[model samples]
Structure formats: C-alpha cells, structure tokens
Target: MALRFQNIKKKFGDLTVIRDISLDVGDDDFLVLLGPSGCGKSTLLRMIAGLEEVTSGEIHLNGRQVEHLPPSDRNMAFVFQSYALYPHMTVRRNITFPLIMREHKWWFHIPLVGYLAKRRIETKPDIRELVSITAETLGLTQVLDKHPRTLSGGQRQRVALGRAMVRQPAAFLMDEPLSNLDAKLRTAMRAEITRLHHRLGGTFVYVTHDQVEAMTMGTKIALLRGGDIQQFGTPREIYERPANTYVARFIGTPPMNLIEAQFQGDSLRIGDRLLPLPETAPRGDDRKVWLGIRPDAISLTTADAADALPVRVTLVEHAGAESLLAFDPGSLRVARDEDGQSDIMATQSGYSGIVAGDRVGLTLDIAQASYFDIDSGLRID
Candidate 1:
C-alpha cells in the first residue's frame, strides 16, 4: 500500500501552490506533512485522497495509478478536521452512513418509507457486524445513539474516525484532524491515533502546522515551505541536521539559536570574540555563515571555559521543570541579525541560577551545532 507522488504540482490558474513535489510513503509509514499555515500541506494530502485534482503528476497506490480516480474509488479514507458528521443523525447513523451508501441504492432513501429501507440496510448481518465492531474499537458503543450536537469534541472526533475505520481503506488521510481540540484533548488524541495506526498497520498521511504533533507522532516528516519541501527525514535528523536555516529555525520549540558569525579558518569570529569550531565541522571558504545551536546544547557557566562565548543575561523565564536563560552577546554584529545589530541572542535551557543583568559564559556543544551559508540559506556542512 505504498503511495508515490511523482512530480506532483498544484496550481490555481496563475498561482502555483505545490511545485514538483515528489515523495514515497512506505506501506506502514506514518508520514506527516508539516509546515506553517498556507504551506500547501493540506492541498497535497487532498490530491492524494482524490479530493483535489492534480495539475500535473502521477499518484500510485500499491503500484497502480490513482490520479484519475474519484474520491470514493481511491479506497483511501479521509478524516477531516471538522469531523463532517451529520448534525441530525446519531453517532451510529453517522458511522454507518458510509457502509449504507456503499451497500444500498438510491431507492433506499425513499421519502416517507426511507426508515424501513434504512432499517433493512442497517440490519443486514455483515453490515451490522462491521459497524458494531468498529463502534467497539473506537469506544463509541455507549454513545451510539447520541447526536453530534450532544457529544464532546473528543467523542465526535472518535465518531469521525470510526466512520473512516469502517471503510477498511488501505490508507488513512488526515487533514489537521485534531486542531480544533483543546490542549489536553489534542495530546490524548495524538496518542490515540498513533495507537490506531499501530493496531491497523495501515499507512497514514497526516497534515498539520504544529511541530510538536509532527515530531511526536510522525515516523517521518516532510517539512514544507512556500509550496516546496524544505526537508524530509526522521524527527531526529530534521532536528539535529536541518537542511537549511529555515528548517533549523522551524522544527524546535524556541527554535535553534542562529547567530551570524564570520567563519575564518577553524574559528568562528563573533565581532571581537572567537569560538573554536569542533573537529567534525566541515571547513568551508565562505566567510559568512549562520551558526545554529539548540537551546539545550548551550551550557551556561559562571567561569570562562574553552570555546565559550561570554554573554550578558537579559531575561530569565521559569517554565516548570526547566528554565530558559536568555543572553545577549556584547559587541557581536552580523549582517542578518533579526532583532538589532547589537543583539546576539543565546538560549540555555534547564538553567535557573542566572538572572537578568548577570554576565555568563556560553559553552556551545560544537559537535551538535550546525552551520548554514548566509547567502544561500543552506547548510554548509
């Protein structure tokens, strides 16, 4: 049940959104399409589900082309963010709608006698058995008679999932399915979806703008930006070795601290200060490059250490279980500085001893750092 996208592109007349997107999703992969809003992640997912027409490309499922197929014929279930359940129908009716439509003809919806026909369709032994089993699997057995209006957001989401599950599709396509829920419910549903994927062994393509969801739930991630893929790899690879400065700044919470420095020989010159490069860092002739270091990789010490850049603490934020220490490197100037020319921000996590106005030395784990070319915005090594 592998899904392959070859040179896929989507355009709305003069505006092109997805351009030359090609990706191979394995049979049991939980591939997440991740990016900021309006990145064409949802459009890409819809194209695969046959809900959006492909401008030009090939989509293959199980080695068979499906780009020309209709949504119902694709054999891929789509779970929408809005749930899209019938407001007037009970949980049971909503979950069983797909099955009934697949099994019955138009005559089944006759005006006043529709109930009799629907009952016959619903009572069919195989359909009833499948619906019952799916309801049980989704923990909706007790709320089968409840309407969507009366159900909790989580419960309604489960019903939507149940509807998709009953289809027994080869793959599941989700478009920001948990975005409407609160923080606690979203966390719970993330684990729930992951468990369902494991239990069913079906390929899943999920789209979301949240990095937390992508990093925590996806087996692999396709990071998109401006209708282009910035990087595609496991969470660890994308986090530790980003493809460029865009990816380096996007995937992390506080984001990888990017400092503009002059790369001269084996030392990175920050204005008047020099920090020694690690042995593994590739030597490049480019004079200007972006130095990327994770917040947790930076160590704050009261005493000066080797390869350390001294900075002055400007802010201290106490987040339960850990603290974030913000520092400003004095006299450092880089051409691409975002805040101001005099600001060189460094974040050190799990550090609480330092307060505002304290001068601390920053020891970067050079081995874990990344370097990106300033002009190209691409990783140098």
Candidate 2:
C-alpha cells in the first residue's frame, strides 16, 4: 500500500507534535521514522492510523485520502510498544478477534460468543486455519492455547504481531514495537521483522528512537527532530551524505566531531594556523565555518603525513579490534598562507574540547570531512 503524509501537522494545545510534515511510502516500501524521544515519531504514526487526529493537513493511503477514516476503515494495522494482548483471552481467540468482529457485527467480538456465531456460520474452521498459519509463521504455534500472561515477552510480542497479520491489512504501522525487549532479543527481533517485511511485501511504517533499528532495518529513513524532518533518505545516503549538520551528528555513532574554524582566502584557519580545505568547499575571509569529521574518517599515528598535525595524546579507547586516540592541534587562526590562496587555513583549537592542556596534531580529512556554515548549519559542499 502506498502512503502519503501531506503537510501533516499535529498539536496539543500549545505544543506542536508534528509540523508541516510530508513523506511518501511507495507500495511495499519499508520506511522508518527515526529520531530521539519526544520527536513526534509516534504522533505521526498515530495520525496515520487515525488514533490521533491531525491538527492540519491530510493523509493518503493507496491514492485515497483517509484523514477522516477511523483506524478500522483505513486498511491498516498498528502494533504497539506494549504487546496490548488481552490477558483473559487465549492466543487463538486474540488472533481471531478481528475476524470474529467481521462475522458478528452486533457482538463486538466477544471472545466467547463471536466464535459461536462463526461456528453457526461454518466460518470458524476457516478463521482457525488462517490464524494458525499466521501464528505458525510468527513462531507462536506452540503457544496457541496459552493465555498472553503465561507467555514470555517475545512470545507475547509474536502474538500481538500475529493479531495484526491475521487481518492482512494493506499496510502495517508499528511504533517502537520492539522497545520493550532485552538487547539480545531486540537484535533477533530486528532481523525477524526485516524478514517479515519482505514476506508480507506490504507497506511498513515503523517509528523508533533506536538508531540501531533504523540503520539495520529501514530501506528508507526519515530522520525527524522537534516536530520536523531533519533529513529523509536511504541508509547509505544518510550515513555518507547527510543533508546537514544535525543529520550528520544524529546518524553516526560517537557522532561527528565539530571543529570550529574560519575561511581565510585560499586557506582554512582553525584558531591560529592555516591549512588547506578541499577545493570543493567555499572560500572567503573570516567566514564562520565548522569542520565535520566522522570518527572513522580520522586516524592517529607518530609517522609524518602531508596534512598530519602532531599533538599530545589524551586518552586511548580500545574496543576489540580498533582504538581511538584523542589529540589537539593547538592554537587557532583563520588566515591564508603567505602563498596566495582561495580558502582559509583550518584552525585547531585542538580537540581538547574540555580540558585543554596539551598540543597534539589534528589531521582533517578535507576530503571526507565536510564544511558547514556555522551560522546557517548548511553544508559547504
């Protein structure tokens, strides 16, 4: 199912949850709304599901506007962070509740009487068969007769998913559905959900604050913050070519290092020294700029390299196969070398972000590193 969120806005009294948000999920696309807590990801998902009303704008599903449609009529299913299973109902009953509702319009899907109507109509067997198949696929077959209370967290989760799948809706909306699981189970569930997405071949709009989930599972990622989208792109595009400083910092581990500098004709000045920037970046004098470098893009050593700046070592953190070294390049300046230049030399206030006591060489990968206009937060590519 294709889904479009067109200028969707949501607010509660004075608080805006989503503002002028627009996004599209092609049929069968797996889209992740990735962000930190209180970023309005859940709010967006709810608006799509009709669990929450949009303060403004509209939502479309499969070319049809569904902003006013109740969740039931939207041809979608929502799996919540809470397993949301009925404790008194057995797995079979829970999974078939929707089917039973369809059969008995007046019964409201009473676990006991809904099946009675299904039996009278001879559709009970068919419902059982379908539910059983879904349960088996989700690894909930063995717990078919157990109450949700008796199942483990993972088992209960599968049951919740089973309930959603049995409806076979055109799309699935999940809001951090795996957040309650432990680390190991969460990793395993991430793989399982990724596979399920392929198996169903249906639009899946997932919301999560977990970057690990976003990076490993999303085919398309919409990174959001403070009720607005920071960037929306494929995982590779987001990680390699972030649209701005916020997206760059949010998408990476340990985050990108932000070194302040200025543009001095033909050289990039950090604090006091002049160095070269990639010919690709803008050039000017005393232009407020920031040097952005991913941790992996940086390396340290005692050997001499053309652009390597030597500095005092601060701390070394070794994580299994790789190690990280902290260094400060010393002083700062935004001046072009005596040689006529087009860009400002980079200044290295040094990486002593906090305790500045020693001078260490800081090497900038002008190639991999990005320059941003500090005042505007726009990339200087």
Candidate 3:
C-alpha cells in the first residue's frame, strides 16, 4: 500500500515534535525514515499506525484517509525494536496469536470455554496450514515447539516478524527492528529483512537512525532532522548529490570533507591553491563556498605531480580491505567543531604505508567534488 502524508504536524503542549511534513511513499516501496534520536521518526510511524494522534493534517493509505482511525482499525503491521514475543507461549502459539485475535469473540474470554475454543481453532486445517507455512518461511519450523527464552536473539526477532507476517497487513511498519542485535547479527538480519521485503512485495515504512541500514535496505530514504526532511531521494541520489551540508555530513562513514573556498570566475581558491571548479559546479564571482570532497576521491600523488596539495598525515587507521588516512590540510580552511581540530580523511585501498607525521602530496578529484553555499549550507548546482 502507498502512504501519503499531507501537512502533518505533531505537537506536545508548546513544543512541536513534527513540523509540517509532507511526503508520499509508493506502493511496495521500502521507505526508510532516517534521522537522529528525538527527530520525530518514531512519532511519525506511530501516527501512521494510529497509536499517536496527529495534531493537524492528514494521512492517507492507498488514497483513503486514515489519520482519524484507531490502531486496531488500521490494516498495518508493526514490528518493534523489542521482539515483544509472549514468553509463556511456544513459537507456534506466538505466530498464531494474530489469527486467533482476529477470530476471537466475547466467549473467547471465558477461561474454560476459551481454552477449548482456542485448541479447536488451532486444530483447524486452515489455521494449522497458515502457521506451518509462516514458520517454515522464517526458518522457525525447527523451533516451533520452543518457548521464547530458549530461542536465540535472531530467532526471536524472526518470530516477531512471523507474528506480523501472519496478519498479512497492507504495510510493515518497523521501528529499528534490528537495533537490539549485535553488530554481526544486525548485519545478518539486515540482509534477511531485505530478502523478506523482496519476497513479500509489501510496502515497508521503516524507521532507523543508522545510515547503513537506510542506505542498504531502503529504496527511498527521507532524511529528517529537527522534525523536517533534509533530503528525500534514493540512496545514490542523496549520497552523490546531497541537498545540503547537513545531509552531506550525515550520510557517509567519515563523511564528506567540507573545505572553505572562494568561487571566483572559473576557479576555486582554497587557501593558497587555485583549482578549476568542477564542471557541474555553479558559477559565481568572488563568492564564499564550501567545497565537498569524498574521502575516496582524494588520492595520494607524487610530489612533482601537477596540482598536488601538500598535507601532513595526522592519523592512519588500518581497517580491513582499506586504510583511512587523516591529514592536516596545512593552509586550507576546513570545517571544524568547537574543538577547532578536525583532520581531512582519505581512503586508500588495502594498506597504505603512509604514517602519521609524514608529509605527502594529495590530488583532489575536482570532477567528483561538490560545492555548497557557505551561508545556507545548501548545495550549489
């Protein structure tokens, strides 16, 4: 199902948590609401599920307004950060809980009668078949008879997913479902969820602060900050051409390097070095701009190479398959925090023999660089 949010706003007393947010999610699209904590990503998801009331505006599910509906009335499944499985129940019982709730009547609340009715319902061929299919699909058939306490973290998470899957809801709303797992398990589960999304072909609205998850799993990403969207686009579009400096700093590992420069005539002046502006960069005369260069785009060059900028290596980290080198751009002005000391990072494949304190010549790939307005922090196209 497709989702549309029109002028949505959420406020708590006097503080507005969500601004006038407006965006559309395509059907069967994996749209990830990515941002830091307290950015209203979870609040937005809850509003869609009807768990939180919208202060104003409308939410549409497949063209039907649903902002006024209750949680039970909305046909969407929510998978939370906590697995939220019933510890007392077996895996089969947990996965079958949604179906049981759907068919439950008033008499199902009576202790003795409820027990017999539930057993009978479980014995039904259709219910049994459905449970069996879901368990097998999630590789939980082997543990169907086990309780939650006996299962591994990943298995328990899968059970939670199976519970939601049994409902066959229009969309899957996940609020950092993999955050509880270890780094290794989170990676594994990320792949599993991506595969599940492909197989189910259901609309998924996921909320996460981790950029890795947003980049790898989402077909479309809405990057939010201060209750407003910084950029909304595919991963490549946001990574390659960020809407502003905020996004440029938030999306990458070491993040993009922002250097202070002067855009004059046909060249950019960074400190004492004058380099040709990127072909795609906006033209301006004596304008202050921020030049953004990705870590991998800067390469180690020979001292005699043309246009080579001299830098002093400050740190060298040997990560598997790549080396991250931090260098001090001697005369070039770089963006820094209150500490006033931030080195520019460059990535080199495999081991780079370069060490800290070593002076090296580096060449910036101007063709791959990005320029932004210094005052506004917005990209200069």
Candidate 4:
C-alpha cells in the first residue's frame, strides 16, 4: 500500500512530539526514520501505528485517510523495540492469535470448548498454513511448540515478527526491533529484514538510531531531530550530499571530522599550511570556517607531502585490515609527553614528521573537504 502523512502533528500534554511533518512511503518501499535519541522517530512510528494519537493531520493508506482509526482498524502491524511476546504462548498460538481474535464472535466468547467451536473459522486453515510457512521461512519450525521464554533473544524477536506478519497488514512499522540483540546477531537480522521486505513487497517504515543500519537497510531515510525532519532522501543522496553540517557529520562510519580553518584567498588553511581545495569544493564567505573531511578521504603517509600539514602521530589503532592512527596536525595544540616530560605544545605549521615530539607532514584531503560556516554551522559545500 502507498502510505502518506500530511501535516501530521502529535502532542503529549502540551509538548508537541511531532510538528506538521509530512512524508510518504511508496508501495514496497523500505523507509527508515533515523536520528539520535529523543528525536521523536519512535513517537512518529507509534503515531503511525495508532498507539499514539495524532494531534493533527492525515495518515493515508492507498489514498484513504486512516489517521483517526484505532490500532486494530488501521490494517498496519507494529514490531516494537521490546518483542512483547507472551511468555506462556507457543509460537504457533502467537502467530495465530490475531487470526483467532478476528474469527471469534461476541456470541462465541467462552472458555473450554469455545475456542474449538469458534464457528469453524474459514481462514483458520489458511492462517495455520501461513503460520507454518512463515515460521519455516524464518526458521522457527523446530521451535513452533515452544514458549517465548525458552527461545533466544533473536528467536523471540522472530516470534514477535511472525505475529505481526500473520496479521498481513497493509504496511509494517518497526521501531528499533533489532536493538535487543547483540552486534553480530543484529547484523544478520538486518539483512534478513531487508530480504523479508523484498519478498513481502510491502510498505515498511522503520525507526532507528543506528546510522549504519539506516544507511544500509533503508531504500530512503528521513532524518529527524527535535520532532521534525531535518532532511529526507535516498541513502546515497543523504550520505554523499547532506543538507547541513549535522548530516554531513552523521552519515559517515568514522564520522566526518570538522576542524577549524581559515580561508587564505583561494586556498584553505588549517593552521599555516595551505590546502588545495577540490575544484568542486564550496567556497566559504567566513574568513574562518570549519573544514569537514572524512577520515577515509585523507591518506596518511610517512613521506613529506607538499599539500600536507605536519602531524604528530600519538596513537595507532589497527582493526584487522585497516589501521586508524590518531595524529595531531601542526595547527592543533595538544599535550605531548617526550622523554618523560608532559607539556602542552602546538605545532606551528601543522606539519608532520614525528614519532614522538617532532612533526611529520600530514596531508589533508582538501579536494574532498567541505567548508562550513562556523557561525551558522551550515555546510558551504
């Protein structure tokens, strides 16, 4: 289903959690709402699920407004951070619970034999087949008769997902559902969810604070902050071309480094060394600006480089294939200990050449660096 929000607003008491935000999820699109903690991403997801009431605006599924509809009537499934599985219920019962509820009439409500005699649900057989198929697909067949307490965290999560999937709603809303699992498990599950989305071919709106997950999992990302969306675009667009300094810093793995710089006519200077700005680099009107560069963009070397600033290598962290070295460029003033004496020293030229106290020339990737206005904190490039 095509899901859309128009002028959406959500308020908790007098505090507004969402403010006239508008967004859309095309059919089968995996859209991620990503941001830091307390950014209202989860609240937005809950609002979509009808768990949180919308203060104002319309939520449309296939061009039909469902904003005011109750959670059960919305035809959308939500998988929460906590799996919220029933400890005593078997996986089969868990997956079939929604179907059973829908099939049970007010007149048929009873204890012992009522469940078995529930007007012989026409969809019961279909639901059972679906539950089995989905459980098998998610590798939960072996544990179908077991309770949630007997399963691992990942297994429990799958059960919760299975329950949601059994409903077969118009769309799916997930809020950091993989967070309870460990790192490796999260990685594996992330791939699984992506694959599942592809197979299910349904609208998926996921909320997460993990930027890497946001970058890798989502077809598009809507970045939020302070109850409002900062920017919305495809992953590549948001990563390669962030709208502002925050996004530019947020998207990268090591995160973009923003160091103070002074513009010297055509060249940019971190301290005394002039950097060769890329032809496409944005020009900053600020005599002083922040030079934003990704760590991967800059190459470190022992040989003196012409465009490089001298750096003092203090620490090196090797992670299997790649090594991350912490260096103090000549422009930065930092405490350095040499021959047992710890003192504050500023590399005058930001030049590099030192294993300890001396400096080594460190080249900044000026071509890839972006200039940001220091005052407004907006990217110039």
Which numbered prediction scores highest in TM-score against the true structure? 3
lDDT of 1 by residue, 77-141 (tens): 99999999988778877887877766664545535233743585456878778878988887889
Which candidate wins on lDDT? 3
- What TM-score goes with each of the models? 0.91, 0.85, 0.95, 0.86
Clashes of 2: 29
Residue 101 miss distance in model 1 (angstroms): 0.8
lDDT of 3 by residue, 131-225 (tens): 88988888999999899999999999999999999899988999999999999999999998899999998799999999999999999999999
Candidate 2, residue 195: Cα displacement in angstroms equals 0.6
lDDT of each: 0.84, 0.77, 0.89, 0.76
- For residues 1-381, what per-residue lDDT tens digits would candidate 2 score against the true structure? 399988999999999889899888888789999998899999899998999998999898999999998887898899999999878778887888777666565766455564563363355567778987998889888888888889988888888888899888988999999999999999988998999998988899999998879999999999999999999888988888778778877787656666777788878776555777667777877887877777667654342445565555555545545555554334432222224221212222234232234344456666787777787777776
lDDT (tens digit, per residue) of candidate 4 on 169-266: 99989999999899999998998899889888889999999999998899989999888888899998887767777787678766666677877666
TM-score for candidate 4, please give it.
0.86
Model 3 per-residue lDDT at 38:
97
Candidate 3 wrongly placed segments (more than 4 Å): 105-121, 302-305, 337-341
Instruction: Identify the superior model by lDDT, candidate 3 or candidate 4.
Output: 3
Q: How accurate is candidate 1 locally (lDDT)?
A: 0.84
